[model samples]
Target: MKRSIKRLVAFVFLFLALNNTTAQSIPDSLAQKIDKLFSQWNNPNTPGCAIGVVRNDSLIYAKGYGMANLEYGIPITPETIFHMASVSKQFTAYSIVLLARQGKLRLDDDIHQYLPWFPDLKEKITIRHLLNHTSGIRDQWQLLAIAGTRLDDVITQDHIVKILSKQQALNFKPGEKYSYSNSGFTMLAEIVKAVTGQSLRRFTDSAIFKPLGMKQTHFHDDYTEIEKNRAYSYQRKNLFTFSNSVLSYSNAGATSLFTNINDLSKWVMNFYTPVAGTAADIDQLVQKGKLNNGVELNYALGISSDTYKGYKQYSHSGGDAGFRTYLTVLPELKMGFMVFSNLAEVNTYEKTYQLVDLFIKDTSAKVNADIRMDSSRAIIKDEGRAKNFTGDFISEDGAQFSFVLRNRKLYWERYGNSDLLYPGLKDSFTVARSPEIKFVFSTTPGKSVLVNQYWPDNKRLLVKYATDSIQTDNQLQMYAGLYYCPELDCKYTIVAKDHELILTSNKYNDSKLKLVGKDHLFTDYWWMRHLKTISGNNKKIIGFEVNDGRIMHLRFNKIQ
Candidate 1:
């Protein structure tokens, strides 16, 4: 009896211990929540996504859902590589700083010192301005399109400099306001080339990629070099099919980074502990810059640092035609998360934040003020004012468009492409195909209306609206003149042709636009819109405006 009792006690103790061990090793319920969030992308409209979460230098969860290459039935995984797009900016900025530390270059040096052929703006713009996006240089991609350059053509540093040199003015005064310009970063890439005598790909490989042991990461210059374990980029088609698209590598600094989540996790670690450079050098790279009055610029060299839900956060996002990505680091909590998608229309940022919030147990975590949207006002029944609101509203880029009312219905267009319209819950409309866009229409005075487009997924683009007036004059004779903005050193000559207004800019072909209202013109493409007669003096037109709020006033000498 004694022997049996001792054996029974031993068996009971062993059972209890095993039960406790199993419970401890099991993943938390939060893991299930994360799985559910990712599963949402498995639908036809949503794109496939890869996600990774790190807690205290350890990977807590890593998984991919749906298909990376739907045509081939390939699945997305944490190791699948995707184009990082603008997220590559931080890496580019770091490379510049590394070169600066080696005495090869100075951040404050004038760009012309490196690229001697660069345009001579009236004001001297320095490398510091480029790094901080205060260079006032016009966006190169837009300029290229205007200059009749093909989007797929290889653009070199010299090409960029040639274009800038010919530019008579800037988009704004240097160091006065902040505008996100890809041209600035492209210039920095040139400076890197001038100093190191090495292409950006080689320099970064030697200085950053190899040092960090990021063997899977690369600049993606040539697609022919078969990349092992690279995720094929995909675009959603009709909720079932996904099409593949190729992105060029000529835009290495501004975009064209091919990487996976595992590599990005290591990159995030460098933010906490410097691996390639000294602590001081790292601080200089990540430290936020400020204006003369000590106000924070809200952007670091390449990364953005801000407060979210009372916690200091650093994050960046990237998007191209076929891929989207996001990386967020919460340094104080020693946690970071990254998400990548092979298909477009994925909410990588939101999904990333949800995972981070679950891990941190911060239910109240909020995004920065600049990214969040204000709550929509309650909708009211149409009070006989619907007729006044019926008209066409256009974008400055001549690509984005919206119609106020048609058969008592509202609609919007993306880049002038016709897709079925989706009904918004309130006084709004959206693309039945795109889940990210929302259009809100409101009435104004004098048969005019206001239309606002809300892109909740795109943090970089604020909600844009246009006020339309029907009293606009369609006659082009009165609007013909040479309009100039000294601040930008740019000129526009308006000419009438075939009942349409043609705007001709330096190095750009004539843009044929139809006058829809007194001062408004709509183009064949939806991204471009024009507002003329912004300034009037006794029935004389003075200036015109672009969609981004840039105004070009006519010179007194040129106006008739």
Candidate 2:
């Protein structure tokens, strides 16, 4: 009887081992879906993408879609290396937290403690502020462009400091608000250098990447250095044309880390298993925090913590000139999803959210069919008369915008930015680095132009443009002073300069605007050109609004 029982037990064990091996294998259904998605992305007009999905610390899916290099006809694969833009933030943040764990530095320490050549901006910004994006530092990318820095030029941490030192003021008081600032993270990368006496890349590689067994990941600076299985970045112009653009690796903190999904799966496992750093260090990395005065903040060091579709989600996204990527983890389910694309055609956030929603809400159901619209052809339009829509339209939230008539076409401009003229779309225009927006004009005859605005990601709004002259009075003057939104942590100083309304933000020097109506002004700036004021009582402007759902009220006192 004992011999029979031992033989039965061995047979059962063997059957279970084979069953587990089969389960670990990629299912045919999933493989087919991956193939379909890759085919869609691989179209000559679409940007190439790399995707990675981890299930319980194992990479269940790691594949590349589209061409990494169109010129070479090189096909992307799971091993292809793509630039992980802001996704590098988490690693940089982890390095800082690791150093803090080792008694090398403190999060609350002022940035000047390590780099004293910083600007004298009155506010004592700490490393915590940098991590949480509460430091009101202007973006170095804008500064670089303004200073005539080339896109391909190599910029170091010290170069960023030199630009910051010349800046006159912060966007707001340090730690007063939370705004996404790549400049803050870049500075942290420099601080990692100053504190550890080693390059940020070297330290991260030795301390984190190596220890985590992420052998395929490296800090990339030059595109010429050939790495094994690196994917070429592509920009899909249409269905048949793609352009090969230079992959950005010059910026390390804000961008420039080459990696693959196979490695990222292991990296995600570290969140729960704690590989290179201690469990305590991992906790610190994901620890939630609020401001000193008790304002809730969503960002933790490098990762953004939020609840999505009934799951606690920690994730970050990266986008450069030609590439886009996302890394998200659901600790409750012990599952993580990452998608990297050489082309920037797909919205990683929307796609990932939809997939997670499908899995959590109804695993048996497929993703919504309407969610799969071709984004390239989607354009918003205004239904009103072309001549009436030619006035300035400002955002109620203080972003300046403009609309002009040139060659019978309506052109849209933002914040002293240049007008993007649409020759045929009537009320629709496209902005650079942004999705297309359209204006639907109201049917009111002989009245000011009122139109609905449509944005990408399925947001819509109605906007009114005044054709009459703006009332110049004391009340309007009171609202004219510089207003700042502490929540957004951005400042807009509205001053009447040289007979034109001037709206100035920290990023741009300032733009001159022509006040064409009661609550509207026009400029030629690239990002924002229209300015609209929201009135409260007695036709008095109480707050300003922008097209991007940002509202700055009259309550924020003038800086002077």
Reference-based lDDT, each prediction: 0.65, 0.66
Q: Estimate the lDDT of model 1.
A: 0.65
Full-model lDDT, candidate 2: 0.66
Off-target runs (Cα >4 Å) in candidate 1 are: 1-28, 43-47, 150-161, 292-294, 363-527, 531-560
lDDT of 1 by residue, 77-185 (tens): 6777888988888888989999889998888787889977676767878877777776777776666654455555666655666676666667666666566777788
lDDT (tens digit, per residue) of candidate 2 on 270-365:
887778898788778877656656766668888898666667778999887677888998877778887787776768776665545434553233
RMSD of 1: 12.9
Question: 320, model 2: CA deviation in Å?
Answer: 0.7
TM-score of 2: 0.65
Model 2 weakest 10-residue run by lDDT? 547-556
Backbone clashes for every candidate come to 21, 41
* Alpha-carbon shift of residue 418 in model 2 (angstroms): 27
